[model samples]
Structure formats: structure tokens, C-alpha cells
Target chain A: MTSPRRVTPEPFVWLMFSAGGVVAALILPVLLVLFGVAIPLGWVEAPDHAHLLAVLRHPLTRLALFGVCALALVHAAHRLRFTVEHTFRLGRYDPAIATVTYGAAAAGAAAAAYLLLTAFG
Target chain B: MISPLEARYYRRRMPLLWWAHRRSYAIFVLRELSSAFVALFIVELLLLVRATARGPAAYESFLDTMAHPAMIVLNLIALAFVLLHAITFANLTPRAMIVRLRGRRVPSRVVLAGVYAGWLLVTAFLAWLLVAA
Candidate 1:
């Protein structure tokens, strides 16, 4: 018989989290306009389709869109956190850096998302 | 009398997630929270404009008090943060788009440059049309 092995169940918490994050990123901007900005600006007097499209199409949209997608990327890597944690037992150096990268990348995405959505949307 | 029906299945969210997982979620939220300022600036300015339209004194106060040096400086700083919030996000959009070309991954910087270039060209053309007319 082969040597007995120790095994730990990989937790899937981050996997679920990133998935939710991706969904939230897309819906948040549209909701923000409808619920937050639009009412204050007076929905009835809001500009017609052409202006709306222009504003939404502005350079900012690309920027804010980064938010929605960034969450997805981090979410992807985060899903493997447990696997990575167990695979080689990496800590302090690469793991710390990975965490930072995830945070920074997400933030960068968010900034782009907000810029694009608000400026263009 | 009508009886209240049993609720359908409800999803459960954890009170607090484990550290690694929580950190990512927090970052997601914090970044979203920071960008709120851009909307605040735009909406506040719109409100100020609307208020100014009401009377001379209102407009004067908007120009004088609200536009005071300290507030202007604050706004300038806010503007920088807002721009930071914007550009960072703009550069990230391509990744989300999932578009690919020529069997190689396209660079986000290229996407950003193309977007910026298009805007500048459009703005220039519009100015020309307006000026000529």
C-alpha cells in the first residue's frame, strides 16, 4: 500500500465572492443612474436619447467599465486561493504580493469603471 | 381572509468572511465607495447651477462663498482623485470586454489611447464645425 496522505478540504468562499462581485459591478452603475442621479436631476427633464448616448459613450465609460471586469479577474484568481494555499504552502512573500496585486488591480478597475460610467453613462 | 404563503428559498450571506476572502470584498467595496465623489461633484455643481438661476444673490453666493479659495482648492484635489478614479478604470475596460485579436492579447494602454484619440478627434471636429458656422 502507498503511504497515507494528509488532506484538507479547499474552501470555496472566494469563488462565490468574486462571482457576486462581477455581477454587482455591471448592475451597480445602471442602478446608480436610475436611482441616485436621475431623480435628483429630474427624470422628466432629462436629456433625450442622443445626449444620453453621448454622455454614456464618453471616454469615462471605458474607465468605469474596468470596475465590473476587474472584480471578475480578481474573483478568478481568488477562487484558487485555497488551492494555492495548500499546493506549496506559500506565504508572506508571494501570497502577500498576490493579495496586494488583487487589491490594486481591483482598485484600478474600479477607477476606470466609475470614470467611464459617470462621464459616459 | 387570505393566508400568507410561505416564502421561497432565500440565499444566505455570511456575517463576516474569512480574512483572505474578506479583504478582496472590502477592496471591491472601498474602490466603489471612493468613486462616489465624482458623482457628488457633478450633481452638486448641477444643483449649484440650478440654484444660481433662481436669483442674483443666489448666484453671487454660489460664485463667492461656494467658490471660495478653500473650497476651490478642495475641489481641485477632489478633481485629481476623481480623475485618478476615472483613468484607472478606463485602462481596465478591455479585460472586461473579453475581446481578442490576431491570436495575441491586446494591451489596455492601446485601448485607452485609441479611446482618447477618438475623443480628441471628435472634439476638434465639433469645434471646427461650430466655429465655421
Candidate 2:
């Protein structure tokens, strides 16, 4: 048989997963705390709408936001794919699962980038 | 009189709800579920960016919508899940990246502490910048 398909995409995927894991773990909670909890709960003074938008308008801020969104998406996708595969015992559907999960994440990242670029432009 | 029963071979797959049986398994599932919430927040962020682009009125309206009681409740739940993800990820990092100090392996607790410390520093800096600007 075709040498049993020597090359696997898993390593590259795992690298993204690992990197995304770090980004998500380090950055996501603080972001959620600030935006989701603190501001909503009135723990911190909420930044006015215009002020926040001005920050988003910055190129560097946009880049960072895009990076965070992309990595967090990838992290979610990889974790979700593996969890579903294992939990459901979908051994035979590995390729399909990988494609759907990672593909969605890639599409999301592209969408985020497009939105950020066009919005600022 | 009852007839003797015949023995039958059965393929027993693990239960679909197997994760519920053990605390560790349940925690694992929760951690995985938290990632979905994280992704949800990112999507929300993207929407916020789009709203901002539309105009100040649109952005202000978006904020008002987000500040609604229902949205606040949803966001609070999302925050809980994100915190779960972050804590579990932090606890697991030392296992993933085994650092060495000279020839000795660094302690796992130290690695975890470093992760938290870094998170604190970044959050502080962001808060400072936001307040200063």
C-alpha cells in the first residue's frame, strides 16, 4: 500500500494547538475579566464608546486583536476536534473531523482579518 | 419452568456520557467546552469591531446592547468558563514545556507561577494604557 501515508498533518496542527494554548491561557482570561466581568459589573470604569473605538482604530491594536482572535479560534478548534473524536469514538472519521474543525477556524480567522482591515481602511 | 438462557457476545462501547463518571473526566470536558466560549468571545469582539467601524452611534448602540441584563449574564457565564480554561491550561503548561535551569529541571509550580505572573503583568499594562489614554 502507498507506504501507509508517511506524512501526517498532525505535527503542524499540534504546533498551532500548543502555541494557541499558550496565547489563550495567558491572554484570554484577562480579556474576559476586563470586558466581560469587570466593566459589566461596574468594577472598572467602562471606557466610552468613542475611546474604545479609537483604540481599535490603531494598526498595532488591530494586529494584536487579530492575532488573539486567530489563535483562540485555532485553539478551540483543535481541542474540540480531538475531544469529539475521542468521546464519540470516531476513529474512521478523523480526516473529516480535522477538516471541519480546522477549516472553520481558518475561515473564522480570515473573516476576522478581513473585518479588521476593511473596518480600519 | 424457565428455559436456560443462551450466552450472547455483545460489543459494549463506552457510554456516550462516560465523562460524567469521573471528576477528572468531567473537568476535562469542561475545559474543552470552555474553548468554545473563548471562540464565542472572539466572535463578539469581531462584531464589536464591525460596529465601531459603522459609526459612533452604532458602536454606542452595540455597547448598550452588550450592557443589557441578559447579555451581562451571558458574559458572566462566559467569563467563568474562560477562567476555567485559563486555570487548567496554566496547571498543564509545565507538563507541556519542560524547562531546564542549567542541568536541573525547573519546578512545575514555578512554571505555573511564571504563567500567572506574566498574565498579571500584561493585564496591568493594558489597564494602565486604557486609563492613561
Worst 10 residues of 1 chain A by lDDT: A26-35
Off by over 4 Å in 1: A1-121, B1-30, B55-57, B98-107, B118-133
Q: Number of the top candidate by TM-score?
A: 2
Model 1 earns a TM-score of 0.35
In Å, residue B18's CA in model 2 sits off its true spot by: 1.0
lDDT of each: 0.45, 0.83
lDDT per residue, candidate 1, B66-86, as tens digits? 445565555655555444444
TM-score for the A-chain in each candidate structure: 0.35, 0.88
Off by over 4 Å in 2: A1-5, B1-12
True contacts recovered per prediction: 0.00, 0.60
RMSD of 1: 17.4
lDDT of 2: 0.83
Score residue A78 of candidate 1 by CA lDDT.
50
Instruction: Write down the TM-score for model 2.
Output: 0.88
CAPRI category for model 1: incorrect
